[model samples]
Target: MIWTIKKAIYRAMHGSLKVMMVLFNLPEPELFTGAGSSLKIPEVVKSKGINNVLVVTDKVLMELNLLEGLFNSLKENNVEYKVFDDVSENPTIQNVEDGLKLYLEGKCAGIIAFGGGSPMDCAKAIGARAVNPKRSVLVMKGLFKVRRKIPPLFTIPTTAGTGSETTIAAVIKDPDTHEKFAIVDMKLIPIVAALDPELMVGLPPHITSSTGMDALTHAVEAYIGVCGNKLTNENAEKATKLIFENLEEVYKDGLNLEKRNNMALASYYAGVAFTRAGVGYVHAIAHNMGGLYGVPHGLANAVILPYILEFSRKDAEEKLAGLAIAGGIGTPIESNEELSYRFIEKVKAMNKNMGIPSSIKEIQIKDIPLIAERAVKEGNPDYPVPKIMNQKECEGIIRKLLP
Candidate 1:
């Protein structure tokens, strides 16, 4: 009876939050897409009267010379830029502080996030810290805390996942507590985004598979969550279909620019959907894994998605059936029960074929309790999941992933 009452209260809060989001009419980034879209950004930055910029990215991408074209374009456009390539895989708060120092020293007028999610997240945090000089990143944790406007922020995603380019979130980790949290506010949304498939064609097969699955998780969680509206549902459905059609094809043939382009679009759509509608326990759990074990975010999401779906399958049955049909895995004539099971099976098959493991080797038996606590804390009263799980139930689910 107590649990039932708590769920009812949670549902009421979710309803109120959904109404507020619809009325707010959140904005999306101005987009540049296709094979050479990233080069267009320098011209736009110049037109915006941004004389100097900070480019945030990871060292691996710098070593790969992946940013060579963007750098050349920035030079040609006369946009003075400083590069901060110290961002980590999960992007620590220290990375943000270091980047902010570079932004200040370079007298940068704007920011260009030029890698995967880590760079984008680090860039967003730097912007937030720059504008709100008195507020620490830890203080800005949770919703609507960053009231100040960030500098002109532009994002270019090298990976077709995380959708950090389009999302109103900047996920950062604290090294001391090993806690990963998000700073979610409209202020963090990028002013512009470039989706260039050329930059994605060189990604390794494992990175390609994991990131594609991450996009699918975003779409699935958004569509089945209670906060979804017409726009989010449409975007999620389109994203799901595109991911189903293109992810594996691109994974097998990483050089296929057309398939890569499709996956990029799918990631953007999923990002847009989840930004407004909210994601569920998969994200909550994945964030914890990234924080605790230093697991890559997409890899953790890829491994945890199927387990979360199975846990919520009964409650999300009709929605999963709809997604099954939208993803071209089931017909409209199929029963919801059958379709739902088929959707879960399809996710399992995708993981298996892509060489993603069913269990995470980094997850230790002793840490299950802590992970479950943090996951439930992050998820409940915000995620609006189809089913509300307590810590005990969450522990049971996490235990399955122990290797």
Candidate 2:
């Protein structure tokens, strides 16, 4: 009876929220996609009328020379900037505070988020803090909690994943609690996004595989999730097809600029899809794994994705079958269930080919209940997952992934 009441309350809340979002008609960022799109950063900066900017990045991207074009563009345009390169793989509240300090100390007029999701998330948090200086970042943890407009922000994604460039959500961790939370608001979206495949050409194969799978997960979940609309469904289908076609090629030959560009577009499309439809249990569980075990976000999602799909298969059978057709994994004659199984098999095969492990060896059996509880709390009433698992069912999925 308690579960039934909770579910009813959630359904009512979710429906109301959806209605409000539809009424709001929020706007997304302007996107530039191509081989050398990062070179347009200075132009965007100039257009936004920002002279001093904060560049949020990580050490590895700087060391890899991925920011050469961006920095050179800023230099040529005579734009002064400060760099905060201490963002971690799973950025923490402390990281956001540190970046905010840099932003304030440097008196930045805008922000340039450079690198993957970590830097972008940190940049968004910093921007949010800059706008609401008196408010705690913790207070901005839930949907539409950010009430004010953030500073003009531009995103240059160095990897072909995470889609943080186009999304209005930022996931930040709390060190004290060892938990991850999201700051979701249209105000947190970037003013511009540059998807330059040139920066992704030198990415390590393992990173490429994992990040590509992250994009795939986004597309799949968006399609299967209940909130999907016509536009989001179309974007998700195209993104899934692009990932299926180009991900392995990009993984094998990272320097193939065409395939790299395709993957980048795929990630952006998937980002757009999920930004509206929202992601499901895969991300909720993966976020917990990152907070507790320090698992890389993309790898954790990749490892747990197939299991979630299997668990949700009954609820999402028709959608899964459609994805199987879209992904070129099934024929028109196949039944929905058969096609869904084939699609799941295709995902497993892709993971195997990309060398993703079947299970995470670090997950302890004792942590299953805690993770499951957290996952349910995180996903329920927010994500439009086709199947909403209880704590016991969530634990079963976790056990399957445990070594």
Candidate 3:
């Protein structure tokens, strides 16, 4: 009875949120896509009258010399830039602070987030700190707490996952507590995004597989969630179709720029869907896994996705069936139940094909309680999930991930 009341309250809150979101008039990032599109961002920055900019990335990308082209392009555009490549896989508050220090000291007029979600998230938080110097990122947690506009922000997504390039979210971990929390505000959306497949041509197979699944999770969650509007539904469906068709193909042949570009667009579409409609337990559980076990976000999402779908399958059956149809994996002749089951099975098969583990080896049994607690806290009253879960239920589902 108490759980029933809680769900009612959550639904009511979500209803109000839908109204608020419409009032917010959320903006999508102006996108530049295709081969060598990343090179165009520097020119856009210069056109915006930004003379100096900060580039946020990670050491792995820098080591591979992926940024060399971007750097040279910036120079050719006569745009001075500073580099902060200390962003970890799961970005910490310290990463933001360190990057903010560079942005301030260099007097950067804007920020260019280069790489996957981590650098983009760190850059967003740094920009948040830049504009609202008095507000700690801790205080900026939850929805719409950012007081002012962030600095002019641009994103170049090297991986077609996380959709951080178009998202209004930045997930940051507290190193002290190991708790990962997202700071969500419409102000966090980037001013521009470049979906350049040229940059993703060298992505390792593991990254290609996991991040592609991350985009799938985003599309699935957004489509099934109750908060979806027509726009979110359409974007999610298109993203689902593109990911289903192109992710594995690109995974096997990373040099296929067309497939890579399709995956990139799919990621952006999924990002747009979830940014508006919201994600569910897949994200909630995945965030905790990343926070506690130092697991890669995409890998965590990929592994946990099948389990969450099974749990929510009954409730999300119609939605799943629709997605299965959209993804070209089902026909109208199939019943909703059959199509839903097929969708979940397809996800499992994809994980197997890509060598993604069904269970997380890193999830310690001792930490299950804390993991479940945080996941429920992050999910409830916020994510408009198809079905609500209690702590005990969440714990049970997470336990299955133990290897």
Models sorted by lDDT, best on top: 1, 3, 2
Residue-wise C-alpha lDDT for candidate 3, range 1-403, written one tens digit per residue: 9999999999999899788877777898899999999999999999999999999999999999999999999999999999999999999999999999999999998999999999999999999999999999899988889999899999999999999998999999998898899999999999999999999999999999999999999999999999899999999999999998998888899999999999999999999999998999989999988888889999999999999999999999999999999999999899999999999999999899889999999988888999999999999989999999999999999999988
Candidate 1 stretches greater than 4 Å from native: none
Cα misplacement distance, residue 121 of candidate 1 (Å): 0.6
Mind giving the per-residue lDDT tens digits that candidate 2 earns over 1-403? 9989887877776677656656766577888889888899898898778899999999999898778888889999989999999999999999999999999999999999999999999999999999998878899998888979889999999888898888889999999988999999999989899888999999999999999999999999989988788878888999999999999888899999999999999999999988888899999999999999889899999999999999999999999999989887887799999999988988899999999998998899889999999999999989888887789999999999987
Give the runs in model 3 whose Cα sits over 4 Å from its true position.
Answer: none
Q: Rate the local accuracy (lDDT) of all candidates.
A: 0.94, 0.91, 0.94
* Model 1 TM: 0.99
lDDT, candidate 2, at 183: 97
Against the true structure, what is each candidate's TM-score?
Answer: 0.99, 0.98, 0.99
Clashes of each: 0, 0, 0
List pairs with backbone clashes in candidate 3: none
Task: Summarize candidate 1's per-residue lDDT along 1-403 as a digit string, tens digits.
Answer: 9989988998998999899889979899999999999999999999999989999999999999999999999999999999999999999999999999999999999999999999999999999999999999999999999979899999999999998898989999999999999999989999999999999999999999999999999999999999999999999999999999998888899999999999999999999999999999999999999999999889999999999999999999999999999999999998999999999999999999899999999998999999999999999889989999999999999999987
Model 2: lDDT to the true structure: 0.91
